[model samples]
Target: MRDGELLAFAEEERFVREKTAVNRYPAHAVKFCLEYGGIDITEVTSIAFGWNAQKYAFVSGGSQMEQFYDSLSKIYSKDVKTLASEKEILLRFQPERIESTLFQALSEVGIRVSKKSPTIQYFSHHHCHAASAFFCSGFASSSILTIDGSGEETCLALWEGRGSQIQITERVELPNSLGWLYSCFTEYLGFRPYRDEGKVMALAAYGRPDTNLERVFDKVTGLVESFPFYRVDPNYIFYGRHSYGRRFTDKLVTELGAPREPCFEVDQVSADIAYQLQKRLEDAVLSFLRHTLAKRPKNNLCLAGGVALNCKLNRVLATEQKEGLFEGFFIQPLSSDAGTALGAALLENYRIGLGRHVPLKHLYWGPNFSNDEISGVLRKSGVKYNRVSSVATEAAQLLSEGSVVAWFQGRAEAGPRALGNRSILANPTSSRHAEAVNLKLKRREPWRPFGSSMLLDAADDILIRSEAAPFMIQSFLVKDSFRKQIPAVVHIDGSTRPQTVTRENELLHEILEKFRDLTGMPLVLNTSFNGLNEPLVNTPDEAIETYLGSDLDALIIGEFVIKRNGTSPSDLDS
Candidate 1:
């Protein structure tokens, strides 16, 4: 992020092949960034960390520690005793600890740095989230909101962004988090809490919310007519052994019935709870934004944090926005904690008078491969392939004939959605293609709908309220006229999360144009190119390995194409 321009950005999980890469330092990610920037660790000017450890410890006083110990005792079903000094030491946040940890991790990667090499800066977690969204949004002034499970002692924050500055307007502390509320229900519905919140959002569409569940949700998270947002009951989340273990209390179970086992199928009760939970979340967030807009009167809204990744909630916010309220909406593509790294960088850059005031154009900031490099890999693998003049035309022709193609091109996307680069491509008009890709190829739940990448010009014809949804972060209603045309990409509720491909994205745009010319559709079903729980393929070798392992019919890398043995000649015919 030198001079406010991104040189390279990537999540460590992509390189390590681990989901979240929990508790691991970003050694590989740092090495990649430094190598790509053509610099050594000594060349770096400053280091920024997202967490304000001292502030967190200061805000969380002795009472908080006592409550945590009590919760631990309940979790173990017995009394646990420890010295106050020991507890203080454990709770204390040390800058040296992080410095030493990074030093060791970087040393393992052959990068050497002295004990006090670079100036280290620490930024508040929610502040980082706010900066990531507000600064990248390019709006001169905007209302900003960051909501996540927990960031130090603060769980949520509201801010106002003006020029190169952002001011915190309000804060919601722990046990009052909308993120934790959603996560609790997410776990209760048999999904991994933070990891599977998206699954809950998808499942909510299948459930029918009833008055009983709505009432329970209202009781669990108190709703009022005015400010301070909704009050989430601490008794249901922060009490006893709940939050430390399963993250919910017996009272929550008593109200919502037993929690679903991990292996259990999605039942009516769980689905209904999810549906109501989603509705309540939307209502609460909308109310807060309305209050903010009324008080501040901002023209743009910038959202970050894990909850901002909820496309349904984002869609609702986009549609409900009125003329004088928020006319523009932007959500950080990497809205999770991983994005806090970006936020920290942006904040530090601004402080140094290198702030950017331009909107983010695209997310193709990860590693990329050249044609020569890809060809070398193909030769080493001994895969039969041809260097065609047009990869898009070839891939489009294959996709039009109900063939699934692995399209790996340019830099891999920085965020979760494939955004055409590292993607599994399928015919969007074929439900059978969607089924095969979901069940036989990806081995994901059949209920999850695949996303689509469409020509930007075609958005108005396909979507009800067509806006430029370049990232797959916002869902829009598929017009009734076009819903049947792209059934494979449309969800049960008739919405599609699409990445609008303009001419700037040359190859993907060309592919969509060619497909529309052939099949009269401007979009193709696009999903991340990886197996069930893996990160998107980062290198050419992993791409080929995944293609060979999956049921995809063709692999398109650079200008070369590899077709399976059984792919009929007719399928490739143009």
Candidate 2:
């Protein structure tokens, strides 16, 4: 992120072949970034970590240990030895130990410098989240909100950014996290916390809140002045040594009924709970923003952290501008912990007087395989393919015929959303396309809705109050008339997550235009080109392997096109 331009960025999961590979040192990711930038470890100026571990340990260690000890007393009633052991575990979060572990891990991965060791700097976790949004937003000034499932004991932080500076106005800590609250509900509704939160969000669309269910949640999260935005009763949540374990309490279960078992069918009760929880979260965020803007008003808003990934919640925040609080909205696309890396870099760059912020134009910052490289892989694999004159035209022609095309071009996308480069594309005009891809190809739940990749010109025609949504991170209501035309991408709530493409995305934009020219529709159903429970395909080999194994209609890699069912690439011309 030198000079506000991203030199290289990638998630470790893409290279490790693990989904959401959390708590793992991103050695491969670091290696890729250094290699991509053509710099040795000695050439690096400084290393910035997204957490201020010393402050976290000093401010939160005692309180967290106390919370853990109390939770054990309530749950077990007589586990003195166990509680002591857990307290010891919590005490191990010392900054010196953390720093030593980091350096040791990096050295093991060949990340050692030949010269003087680079100066390592640590920034507050929430501030890093704020920086990621406010800096990349290209706004001169904005109100920033960062919320996540407890980053170094800080659950949420609010900031005001002006010029090259950002000031933290308020901060919330520990057992009162909106992210943890949402995750608790996500777990209770037969889903994995943090990982399956989007599933809960999707399921909410199918539910209507029951008054009793609403009351239950409201009671657990009563209004309080100590926490300005929201409140969570620690009694209803377990703040434990291992944050990844089950977080909901027995008290919550006693009130809300038993937790749903994993892989079990979602019942009406679960849906109703999801609905009430989603609404509660939205209400809290809206109230918090209203209070913030009314006191010290700002026209632009920037949001980051894991909760910002909720497109539905983002829509609520964006549309709230009608009430005259803010005029502009920008959400960091990689709004999770992954984004903190970028934020840390930007913060360091700013400190060194190199923070001439360049607004993010695109997220194609990872590895790219050339045509010759792709050709070599295909030849080695002995797969039949043709080097088409224009791969976009060929891919579009295949899509117009209702075929699902694995479109792999340019660099892999930086975040979870597939912005065309590594995508499984289908015609969005028919509902069958989505169903077929979900059930037969990707092998995921059938109810998960696909996103649409449309030309920038089509946004106004397709969505209400359309804005430039190139990142596919914001949801917009589908214009009633256009909903039926792209049913594959439209959610049950009549909203669609769209990546609006312009000339900057030349190849994907060209593909969309060609599809529109043939079918009278400007969008295509675009989903990540990965199999069930797999990270997105990062290389031509992974793309080819997935394409060969799945029920895809065609594979488009660089200039080469591979079709199934004995179909020839020449047929695409006809």
- Candidate 1: where are CA atoms >4 Å away? 56-93, 243-245, 262-266, 322-324, 566-574
Query: Which residue pairs come into collision in candidate 2?
Result: none
Q: What would the TM-scores of all predictions be?
A: 0.92, 0.92
Candidate 2 local lDDT, 109-192, one digit each (tens): 788754476777888889899999998999999989999887766788889998889999988776678898999888877787
Per-residue lDDT over 1-574 for candidate 1, one digit per residue giving the tens place of the 0 to 100 score: 7778888889899999998787788999999999998988887888888888554343444444355545554543421223343255445445667777887888999999976587778898999999999988878888888999888667878898988889998887766788989988888877888889998898888789699887788788866775566788755764534533356777788887778765334566777788888988888887777776687655678999999999999989887774445777889998988889999999999888887864788988899999999999999998787777788888888999898999999988888789989999999886888987976468887777889999999999999888888889999999999888789999989999999999768999999999999999989999999987898999999999988888788898887788886433333321
Candidates in order have lDDT scores of 0.82, 0.82
Any idea what lDDT model 2 has?
0.82
For model 2, the superposed segments whose C-alpha errors exceed 4 Å read 56-93, 222-229, 239-245, 262-266, 571-574
Distance from true location, Cα of 504 in model 1, Å? 2.3
Give Cα distance to truth, residue 484, candidate 1, Å.
1.2
Candidate 1 pairs with clashing backbones: none
